[model samples]
Target chain A: MNEYLENAKAQMRKGVLEYCILSVLSEGDAYVSDIIRRLKEAQMIVVEGTLYPLLMRQKNAGWLAYRWEESTQGPPRKYYAITDAGRQLLAELDTAWQDLGDSVIKIRQPEKTHSHEKRI
Target chain B: MKNVFNICINGIIFGIEEDAFKPLSDYLEPLKAYFSREKDGSEIVADIEARIAELFTERPGGAATAITIADVNAIISTLGTPAAIAGVDESANTEAQPCAPRRTARRLFRNPAERYISGVCGGIATWFGMSPAILRIALIVATFFIHWLPILYLVLWAVIPLAKTTAQKLEMYGKEVNITNIEQSVKDNSLDTGSPVQTFFRDVDSALGRFCRILLRIVVLVIGLKLIVAGLMLLVAFIVWTCLQDVLFRDVVKWDFLAYEEMLRHIISASSYQIFMICSVVFILLTVAACLFWGAQLIRPFKTGNRMTHILLAALWAGSAMGIVGISLREMRHFTNPNSMSETFTVPVTDTLHLQTVSANMKLSNNAVTGLYFDKSQQRFFGEPTLNICHSRNGQALLEIRRRALGRSKPDAFDKLAGIGYQVAINDTLLQLPDLFSVSPPDRWSFQEVHLFLYLPENTIVAMDEGVMAHMHSNAHSRTGQQEYLWRVTDKGPRKIK
Candidate 1:
């Protein structure tokens, strides 16, 4: 039962990871390291390695684009930016997130009333 | 000190320790494989490499510091495993997945870790999924039947590269070049969670390895037994040959009356001969002892002696070998200077002159010794002389006797030549020569030899006896082992008169 809960939690995280990457890129043009830092700060991804393939998949679908930039510390970095398609996808995901939040609140309202009655 | 390699990752050069490099690369291999299924797989890998480079640069020592295994493990945890990076639950995969791609093509590389000599056999055993000990034993047995096997082994040693890197080691065993296997190989174990088929093959490989190891142990035991037997036999032979020379080899060899040391005393000087005898005895004893000890140790490994005992035995063997070499070099000075003395006697010219060989009136004994003969009656040693017939430079018939000996100097050689005695008698038309020359005592056997040259005038006829055939050294005539032959001395050489 615990294993199923852990697996379901992972699935839920994975489903929203792409939407989070596009949202992070919508802010500004960022390199892989910068993007990974933002996603990790928000607890959207566990490993930095997981973000590369998601970003690649997004770029392949014309939702994101990247450019090579020289770095002072090491090799050249690939800077990623949200394309017009990516912005459109992010706007649609924002509305969908809002609708899901509203539905959860409405469903909890009845449960809260029943729990309160049981307490009385 | 750990070996350090300079590697370029994502166009950024970094120095990494050998132990660290294996795990680091192992972590990257599966990531590369997993990402390769995507459209921009290479780009993703390159980006990952770039991030790793950045992480390395951000360390305390920066890029100047060599990466350690701890650093690599830290980086791996941060990046996560290939399954984790792919967002797949590692726990679930472990329960369901096979350990690695089964039986990839194995490459030939010398295994440096588990090696006895240069890792050739160890590498071959690993390649074939067997035990190294078995391969080593088979090679040793093969060396006896195929003499050039050592040369081929040397060639292979030079040709095969050592599996120095983790990926190379994985390739050597035909393990898939992936993160999990690399990690497992580095840790020196198989994955705890593998499918039933992978588990079955692993069990079989280990079982075969165990079987080969047992066979190798048995072969070593048998070899130890053989060596003990051989060493004991050699010891007994040496004792019999040295102590009971007269009883064991009396009829076989003429020197059987003299003991081993006594025979040496006849040839070498008194003072040096003693040293030679001591060195030779020590050498023989040490050799036999070493053989026995080695055999015993192989039969029961590390059961008898410690490192100190081995060191002492090695030192004694080396010392005895050096002593033998020194004594031999000292004895070789006697043969440095060789001198010869020749005498010519004019013979009566006749149409036909008879040439004959006279024996010493002693029974010819069939002896195994060569070059030197012992005269029991006179208590002296005699050596055979050579006889040759040639045309005379002048018109006179002449007979020349040349005696040669080796000594310390010219005069010493001439003094030793006085010990060599060869008698020749000219009776009008008949010439008689002694078959052997005597070397009396105080001069020793110093390669003493005599040569008789019978020079005849042109058209002079000479008749040779059958007894002289043994001493004949003439290439002009075809020796058919005939009883007697007549030859006429011509300008060119002696021509057979039939």
Candidate 2:
């Protein structure tokens, strides 16, 4: 039963990772390390590898952008932010996520729509 | 060793190490490539990256942290696959400009490069959302390893590219496609030259640099060739000395003990040529030593700058070598002498008269044995020559031996025998043999009344040989210090001092 819930959560997490990353980028320029921290706190995505490839994929797709900002520690690091395309995708992903949660509940328990506080 | 693995993402290469970055980079590349292909998937990848970055910020800065592959796989699963993103984008892209610039989030800059290869160039391009080719080429040209520029170019070419996934693309131009390139490049934008003299010197400096490089290359080539030659010579000398040296020693002291003077005589005679041999040995040693010095010079130390120490060291090295050679000719001559003179000589058979030509040639024909005296009283091969002897392949007709003996022949003896008194006779003769021969007289003979009689092996023509006389005179005059002792009749000649 726990495995089943975890599997669903994992799938949901995948679809929503873009939204989560964009959310952090949406706040301000964040280094890879910092972004990882924020995502972990939100329990959005726990793996670190997914981020680099995902960042590359989005950069390729022209949804997110970056600039090189010199740091005092060493050479410059690439700071990231959400593009307009990124913002649009995040909105769609956010709505979809909410719909996904609501639809799952509506399907599993058709007669219970009274309140939002429901325990798994 | 924390072996750094070069990780290439979006066609850019980065030397990524620390277990954390390695797996992170490995996991990111393929996923990024997949996301870039799906239109809406770019957003998916970007979101996932942002989330990952958020996680990184959450970690306490420490060496023990390691990013595992499971962490990557889990995040990848959450980000959804390319096929799903494509399906969603396809269904959503019905209206005009349906892939609208999402206005939901805003940020100051784009962290476009994720575990990307040397982001120096890629970062510059992504900073302005420009194509990376020009930047990459510029970086390549400026790289200090200009000879290996092609290799580096290919690596960067393969590792870094325009952002591939939605996340990377957003990151690249993600900084609202800023006009960041106007000032942020590593290359200087303005050239300020106010002084003509400065410009002139700069030109001179560059020209001088070219000249020096050309000259240095030629010098290095010549030195390298010389070094090889010297090395080969050293090897040959050492091998010959090591292998044949035994034969030389054996042939001299053991096999044919009598030919010691004929061949080995030059080696161990009382006035043996150990000095010359010592000089030669030193020369060979210096050859090897010099070669090694040059061999060590070939290594390059610094990464970017010229090796100044190489030049100075080479100069001092060569100078010191010459100095060492100068000193060695005079001093280190005692080391490799092959000559072994008997501790003492007998005088009965080596009578005072025949001792001068013991190691000298006599005007005698083959099939004639010269008479040599050995003194049982003195126990030395003093005057004449040793009787029992062995000759080389060309058999000996006359034995030239070096023995110290007193003067037995009076100066008037040759006058009485030749019927010529106080008159020197000079007849030049050329004797055929290998190597040079020397003459020595007994310590007791009086030079003024000395007369030499060649009891040469009978049957040969005897002549007043000028070559022998001149050589003997030179030998006598050049003595270390005069004992003033009368020399025996020189086997060299019947040259009476005029």
Q: Highest TM-score among the candidates is held by which one?
A: 1
Q: Model 1, range A1-120, lDDT digits (tens) per residue?
A: 998897778777887888888888888999887888887898877777777777777888999998988877665678889999889989999999999987887687988867878999
Best by DockQ: 1
lDDT of 2 by residue, B1-498 (tens): 565555433332344445646446544444454444456545555555545543333335421344344544554465443333332333234234444543323222222342223444544554554444455446545776567766865675565554433334433444221112111111131111111224554464456557756878777767767776778788786876646655666544432222212222222333434543454455566567657556445433234335786566556556555654664453333222322112222122222222111133333211112222223233223222212222122222333332222122443222222221121222223222211221232211111121222233222332223333323423434333433233323344333233
Deviation in Å, model 1, residue B474 alpha carbon: 8.9
Candidate 1: deviation at residue B262, Å? 3.3
- DockQ (0 to 1) for model 2: 0.04
lDDT of 1: 0.77
Give candidate 1 misplaced runs (Cα > 4 Å). A1-120, B1-161, B164-222, B251-261, B296-302, B351-368, B374-381, B390-396, B409-415, B439-441, B457-498
Docking class of 2: incorrect
Which parts of model 2 have CA positions greater than 4 angstroms off?
A1-5, A114-120, B1-498
